[model samples]
Target: MMSDCPVVSTKLGKVSGFALAKAKCPEAQQVYGYLAIPFAKPPVGNLRFKPPQSADAWKGTRDGTKYPPGPMQSTRYVEIFAKYVANYRVADENPRYFDEDCLYLNLFTPKTSNKAKLPVLIWFYGGGFSAGSSVGYHGQTICGLQDVVLVVPQYRLNAFGFISFGKNSSCPGNMGLLDQKMAMEWTRDNILAFGGDPNNVTLFGRGSGGISVSSHVLSPMSRGLFHRAISCSGVANCNLVTKENNDVSTGFLLKELGIMDRDPEIILAKLRSLSAKALMEAQEISAEYHENPLQKLDDFVTVVDGKFLSKHPRDLITDGNFAPVPFIIGCNNTEFCGVLADRFPKGFVTGEIGEKQAMDLTKIAWQVADNIPSNKLDEGVGLVKKEMMRYISPDDRYKWSKLPTNVMLDTLILLPGVEQAIAHSDAGNPTYMYYMTQQLRMHHNRAFSKDMTKKPEFCEADHIDDEVFTFGVPFGNGPVAKEMKFTEDEKNLSKQWMSFICNFAKTGNPNTPMSLTNWTSFKRDDQRHLVVKMPLEEGVDLMGERFEFWQNLRAKMATT
Candidate 1:
């Protein structure tokens, strides 16, 4: 099960990575790990905004026992930074990391068997479009037992990765997506040497990574890059910025950057040329931009760029543009309650600043969207803003749960799951859905604030609860994280997820004799949900009546 060879090699040289878990650590002695490994040449200097090129050949052996720093970091989340460094460990002498010259990936195999080409599972980390790395509290045992190739690639993010230069062919954006495409192509060509089956690849990601994977599944440019898809705890939403299209979104950015006139080409060119630090500093002016995930999402995301991405990923999925491959997509039980604990004072049932007032605020909020027809923009951005305000800011934060809870109940939990379920059902793909109800032995209140904590009767299946179990990495080494080891129930859940994923990778269908009992596929007519509940019972429906009401509201929104 252990191998002393690097999974990938090129002209530069043969870098060797050892199986730390299976070879060194007795606790994880059964798990095989290939640490920091390169997939493409470093993107720096002249190659900064360009596509990935080959790295120079190395004459001697390269030691890839550690992960390279990825992209950049911000100062706000000190705790998060500590966790990141801890996960992406480095030698003691070199502490400061985070660079653009990180085009490496780490692939962990349970065992190296040349006789059989094992299934490959590629992972994408989450950090909106701003920041995140492939190394974190990710689990290694499942890959070892499941006998698959676990590939984790480090892609570009934020201004360093996605900002474009006014449609200039030379100044291309979306470098992050390009890097990912190259990694997949690398897997296709070289995975065999690592004892992995190139043809049977499943793209899996959470949060930002989920959105990225979904975009790949829906984009024509990403066709054939991967065979199956799994998007967790993320949406498939995106908006393109332009003079005519994003005046409101751009106006705020321009005002913050001290630009009076809304010049897409001139200002964008100057902004693109600015140092990464300068760009990061200036971007801080628009607080809304940083708070929202989309603004900083890799400088290069799915756009209406005629070449790589012709249309938005969501629209494509809605229009039945899926690859007919198997689909397993789900979101956390609660999403927005992440850092800004839920505190909705009013009922999301009605916007605090009503639709009319929101329309007025929209004019101020969006500085650059002067060209968008008022009625059209109001119907679009304005409406979304009004709804968001209601969800994010409640009239009260303590001793009560109003709009925040209602929004979580109505939108975050149910909508994304049911939508994708219906989409997969229409395409006749076997889509197995999941609801993460298992609360951490600790942090039940920390996630959504003690005030907004659910009743003991009502379990917290909060936004990040799944990450703990899914990755086998503790979020905060709290007493619960340290003491509350995975019990038989948690192990069963993990095994169930593995069974579904492994079977799906092995065959097109994930249905098996040991499937969760009564868990049903999405039915457009019946509208039944196989709610995953405590004690892990199936057919335990969620807030079914409220969900149906919300679903109808969504249908009505589309028609109007």
Candidate 2:
């Protein structure tokens, strides 16, 4: 049985994989999965906060059958959110073991020879750079259906992945991103043995993973490693990407860990000496120091390291100092619905919010003025609140609830998406933009409410809705599929979506197959975007007024 397994000789060693069960991917032509192949040496012990090192060659064939343990992270919030709001289970949600040594990758391929020359898609899972794993997403369906090779890499999470102590410190930031870079380099050298075209590689991801894709495009270190890019629901300029001082963040974590040393060498030695569990626990406690609500989303985040990133991503993109590759970027219609529901459950359940609640929410929405001076903060907040209030009627409570949700959707997701698209298109990159409008059938939020009875004026698509379709979850027999029901139309939609994505991966254009509607290139003047739904429709100027409002706000903040 051991000898019967499929084995491929990589640059480092020989690794064996198992044939995917037919039940897992009924539509797949032929998919073989090589799971948990070590791409870099484990980021553990003495190498804890340093950049990833290439894995050493092995003496014999390595077993890659079992899924790797998820990178170390606190899972309390993930479990609650997944079960209640998202209405789906996260694959390998909480494994029996978690570790700092989580730098492995899973490969699914249709051809196992160097001559197959299939296109390759490498995915980075999105957990806001705090919590997520490469375990649950099965690439068998994508590889089998699209005739390509799919790779999902695991990186360090939480403080272990992104801890930094400023310019003079030994611990520069972006360990997670560096881990992804190492994986790409490894793939470039060894994917041909797995029947993949190293030259035709495409990087795609959602949420923070999407942000990572955009970051790679801006980084000098990541140039020439990937050819094309796809970012869903997030980009480098998204509000979720933090602008906090990393030195302050590191100081907070040190305080939480009871370390008072001010010396960089002493701090690095102390941090490296702590156990993974101790570091993770301290990172969680350090959240109290971040006063900004948005900054608290993820305590550890990517920084503009001089080597990996020479300047801010927005400045780099504006100055045309990035890898100009074919890009696909967009977000769901209501990317913040779940967060709204979780935050104001009563308002969502009742379809109404108190006047005070509405005003408080408006102030929170205006926090996007992160650069506004303290002297002008009150004036700016008042101006935004006044404009936002005009959209809501005093007699209607539902309007009150909808106002904040709309503002959040605009600031956090939609505005950033449009800005990134405009930047890429203006710089002469072939860019395609999409807006997902198809709502999931299983979850009934009714515009950010848990109540199924209340029907909103329109259908709303929540965060990760596009990812669900992109990964072909509806048609597969995985944990996500078992939790919910999918209609015949939804299943078919998943197929079409995968086709478009794989087509882009193969040819750098989604419309090459010509089976679906023609997706036009996004232009600076036109600003057209594809409305992703059944019987796909085309439109121009998605949420124009809201986009302009944010633009005006930024302009005013700059002048004041």
Clashes of each: 18, 0
TM-score to native of every candidate shown: 0.75, 0.91
Compared to the true structure, candidate 2 yields what TM-score? 0.91
Q: What is the lDDT of residue 118 in candidate 2?
A: 94
lDDT agreement with native, every candidate: 0.55, 0.76
Q: On residues 152-175, what C-alpha lDDT tens digit does candidate 2 reach at each position?
A: 999887678888776456777888
List candidate 1 stretches off by more than 4 Å. 1-12, 22-29, 54-57, 77-96, 137-139, 165-173, 237-273, 287-302, 342-402, 405-414, 445-459, 473-484, 511-520, 527-534, 540-560
C-alpha RMSD of each candidate structure in angstroms: 6.7, 3.4
Q: Which 10 consecutive positions of candidate 2 have the poorest summed lDDT? A: 83-92
Root mean square deviation (Cα) for candidate 1: 6.7
- Taking the tens digit of each residue's C-alpha lDDT, what string does model 1 give over 1-560? 22554444533456566553431113332444555667778876556667677555666667666667766544443233332122212122122366767788777765555546888888887665566776553335556446677888888865456555434345445677777888888778767767788889998887667767766776677778688887776545433221112233345556677777445456656565666666555544453554333243322344444445554544666888766777776655544333323222232212332444334434322322122343554455534444545434454332122333334434543555566667867787766556665654444433333322232222355544565555433222211212333345655565566656676777755556887744455455655444444455554344455546555544544566
Assess the local accuracy of residue 119 in candidate 2 as a C-alpha lDDT between 0 and 100.
92
Error of 1 at 51 (Å): 4.0
Worst 10-residue lDDT window, candidate 1: 474-483
